[model samples]
Target: MKVLLLVAALVVVGGGIGLVLVMKSAAGPEKQATKVETGDCVQLTGAGKEADAVKAACDNPQTPYVVSVKGTVKGDCPEGFYSYSVATPLRGEGVGLCLGINAQVGLCFDDIKTKTPPPLVNCSGARLKISEVFDKASYVNSPCKEGTEEVISYTAYGATQKFKSATICFVKP
Candidate 1:
């Protein structure tokens, strides 16, 4: 009788462990605060032209910018792309990333000209609204819709890597 009870208890505990493991796996990998994603938000630290980029949860009110493009070797970021360095900029050890205030359509920005990536704001104060997004960049002629008033493009260049770029279309709200 004692042996049977012990075996039963072990089976129950094993089943519970298996269930927990399954649940954990279904939830997917945990996101690190400093990790990079195409449309995830990040926080910038320091002052003026010198600053550091750290991944921040989109839910955080402070994280106003999302990555529009990554891994750029070009000397400068394309128009409207906010340049960011993953490593210490003083030593030039990190690759560059281009960021945007909104990751997709239906988002708004107030002061894109004066602010890098700008701060995502309510529609009431927004001067521009994101209308479209494309994976290509720098069209000789604007390919956006007739109402589009702003076009921003960012591109990545490396000797061996394939080219990558993104374009965003915006209109006055």
Candidate 2:
């Protein structure tokens, strides 16, 4: 009985130590951020769900391109029309889409010839909040020399509240 107890104790202790190590390893250093360069004429048109906005941009019907998501607004994404669109010059040509307020933020890439909708890569900070509208929120996905993700920051109505900040990410597709 004593021997069995000893074995059980050993197992318990070993498990505890393993758990601690795992938790510590999981808590690695914070990732460096990508600075997003705002305002380059990425726009979303029509009205529809946020997803629709993404789809329209992906199905641009105008050019052959790959769309990388920059940012999005969820509140205004319409249900039957293209709500938003943002174009980028990465991977040939990249476009973004949004619906405003609750719309999610992420990356989108499309191949024009086949009109395929590739999976969107949701970067670390891909959330929208009411604060976003007043304070300005943005998506930052610039590549770093080290290959790590870049840090993107958004500032809405810095001092005066005349105009709100533009949607950081999302344009059309």
Give candidates' CA RMSD values in order: 11.1, 18.1
TM-score each candidate: 0.51, 0.19
lDDT tens digits by residue: candidate 2, 110-149? 2111222222333343331111111344455332223222
Q: Count the backbone clashes (under 3 Å) in each candidate.
A: 0, 45
State, as a TM-score between 0 and 1, how close model 1 is to the true structure.
0.51
Q: What are the lDDT scores of the predictions, listed in order?
A: 0.65, 0.31
| Candidate 2 lDDT | 0.31
Which pairs in model 1 have colliding backbones? none
**lDDT (10s digit) by residue, model 1, range 1-173:** 99999999999999999998887676443323235656566777654334556787665656666665666335466666677654432333344667766435777877667525576778777898888878777668766889888887766556543334667888998
